[model samples]
Target chain A: MTAAIVALGVVVGLLGVLVVGLLRSHADVLRALHDLGICEDDLAAAGTAEGRRTAGRRTTRTTGEIRMVPGVAAPGASSSLGRLVDVSGVDPHGGAVHIGLEGSRGLTLLAFLSSGCGSCLDFWRAFATDEVEQVPGRDTRVVVVTRGPEEESPSEVAALASDRVTTVMSSAAWDDYDVPVSPYFLLVDGSRGVVGEGAGGSWAQVVDLLRKAAADAGLALDDDRPRFTRRDLLVGRDRELRADRELAAAGIEPGSPELYAPLHAAPGDGADGEDGAR
Target chain B: MTDVSSYGITARLPRGWDARIAKRPDPAGDPAGPSTRAAPEEGISTRSAPAEGDPPGPLAGTEHPVAHLANFPLPPVRGDYGSGAVELMRADDIFVALVEFEPEAASTPLFSHRGIPRFGVNDFSPHTMQRTIAGMCGAQAFFNRNGRAFCLYVVLGSHALRAPLVAQVNALLAGLEIDPL
Candidate 1:
């Protein structure tokens, strides 16, 4: 009777786990597959098409980790990325809001632009026409960082914006972002973080990264505070101790807990150094 | 610098042309792997990979840079260069073609850069050499360098062999009248 009971419980548990896993992240899984370019209709063709390496070139026969290209190495970008720069070069109206906020965060910048770039003309015209929002910490009634070449006359700036656009004439601190091209705004998140190879012509992609930059600035607002969480290993110990209680209850003979107390660990976290197996 | 002495043609072939030539055993013995999937009825090793006793692929063109060397022998029928066997992909009227060049297999391009030319001997006809080379056993024409060099390419699957192979084949033009580039 006891064996029959245990068998029934195991079956029920497995079925429940399967159903829950399927319900969660099914949409993300589908998106990941689509991004990976896997499709049911062209599965066979796709396999052969992308399956081979560059045409005529011999397939590289080396084992793992030996790289072909040199110098351009990825130092280490493990966690979330850093600050992004959004260069806005449009303004409408006179001096009141025109000349302001160029050198705020010790950041150097250079923006090569004129009203000539079609995409820039469109975005600037929109901001000048609409009320823009101010980025936090900076003393500004309206938003948007609009600075450009010294050659650009006030009339050209006016031509790009409307009464609503809040303009700022900042210094072209060139060394700050390592300005590669025109209308390029490079943002260094801090001394340690830098953003490169960003969207140059595509405004939509730039705007998305711009929003990410704002979010990144907000993260920096924690400023001087020493913030610690489970990743710091301090509070995490309490959580680990609590996890022990649950495992203890789940083990054989709870209070006494089978001669050896069950130790909890991740693949590499074990003190016994079995981590090398991974 | 492989021991080419095993191939009967080695002594007759020049020492300078060695790097461009790799002798491999005929894959006719292995009934599996890629060569097995080739034109098995023809008895030639069809897989693009070279087998023992095979020659290199087609030469790029008539004006192949090394065409001047009179003594350079094309890859011999049966020799081993440590990179498997030589593969011969083409033999045509445009050029007498034999492909051999091992890029990564052997330590250097041509071990010691030493070579020999066996075909340049008095009796062999360089002008009508296409028919003589096409008769090589295993595989027929394979391209060593596509059209890049004065090289010829016999199609494999849908693509052609690349440059490194062509350079080797060009080096094989020993005893030809053309001036060295």
Candidate 2:
């Protein structure tokens, strides 16, 4: 009986050691997956991450305490500000096309999507149905950018394109924008450059992310600034021309008394009832 | 510069310019055609007397290819001659349209020009504008290229500034290529 008891104790010790080893191995696997941008939720949902990179440069996540916002994911570490230069690439029809982003008036949303990415299907379908308009509003133009013909099939991109959206297959644009993954977005204000960028699981999340980004950038979507009409420009020009003609007819050239007389008038003595003199 | 080609028409757009090449939708809603939607109007509507009658639909005839290039943002929906987009132009803005006709029209008098016509400052006129918007000028050229009949219509935001603007238009046209239909 004493021998049997000692043997049982040895067996239990071995089992404990095996259990500890298994736990450590599982933890290491999880850590590696995390490094590859796969989270526990992703694993639980799909069993395997779609478009999982087997071997390549990994995108570095931002360090420090990240305050996660509900619905909107934080931007990747590669995000930056500045004008997005012209995007040159081949269209779905195999013709080369260049899209000028500089000096434009409104926002241009560059959607980095891939035909092979399962997550990107959601965006493609949304764009086809015009649901993307709800996110950026009518003022923003959406341009879908995919990898070049070498990395992607132009026919597949064409099949996924919507007549309403302008799609460009440009691998250079991906490199220029530092796109780390598929289904990423960069919101560029024509005058202000890149104001927001990030990834979202769905269009709803993207809307929230862009809204937060624009707000943080101090851009109001409701833009109430007055726009000058063509008539206004013409009227202003005509008034200036007429004033010049009248002045010339009266022989009132530059530095004439008539022009300076209004300025030198005493306060509250001007025709317009405003102070002309200090 | 970027080369955009579709339906046998091609253009090389310069920096700060946007372009599109597409075919008008079949009015009969052919499943094989590009689209089934009606063609958009080419200019702002100014209601004439009812006796003058409403203008004919822009795409009332057979379907053909159309291309648009603009120095400013090109809206997804616009007329062949830029009705919807012209309203958004600034003083320095420009819109160019290249509309193709049936191959048989290549010999017609309107399309008598053998090749693309060069644009000059005199080509643009304020009275030639589609909608008569102040400060805007327009020019049109009908030509035949490689058995295809084509019309090149250009709109400038400022008629007084057509010298430099027409030069830009001519430079853009210089890079245009039309493949056999």
Instruction: Give me the candidate number with maximum DockQ.
Output: 2
Q: State the displacement of the C-alpha of residue B23, model 2, in Å, after optimal TM-score superposition.
A: 4.0
Q: lDDT of all predictions, in order shown?
A: 0.30, 0.70
In model 2, which runs have C-alpha deviations exceeding 4 angstroms? A1-77, A90-97, A128-130, A136-138, A148-160, A226-278, B3-10, B24-33, B36-65, B126-135, B160-163, B179-181
Instruction: Report how far off residue A37 is in candidate 2 (Å).
Output: 21
In candidate 2, the residue pairs with backbone N, CA or C atoms under 3 Å apart (3 or more residues apart, or in different chains) clash, namely: none
Q: For model 1, how does the per-residue alpha-carbon lDDT over B75-148 read when each residue is reduced to its tens digit?
A: 11111211111233322101122333332322332222223222211112212222233332222222222212
Error of 2 at A177 (Å): 1.9
Q: DockQ of each model against the real complex?
A: 0.00, 0.11
Clashes of 2: 0
TM-score for all predictions?
0.25, 0.61
Across residues A14-79, which tens digit of lDDT does each residue of candidate 2 receive? 999999999999999999988767677655644344424521222232132245444334555666
Model 1 iRMS: 35.5
For residues A187-213, could you state the per-residue lDDT of candidate 1 as single tens digits?
333223443223234334444545566
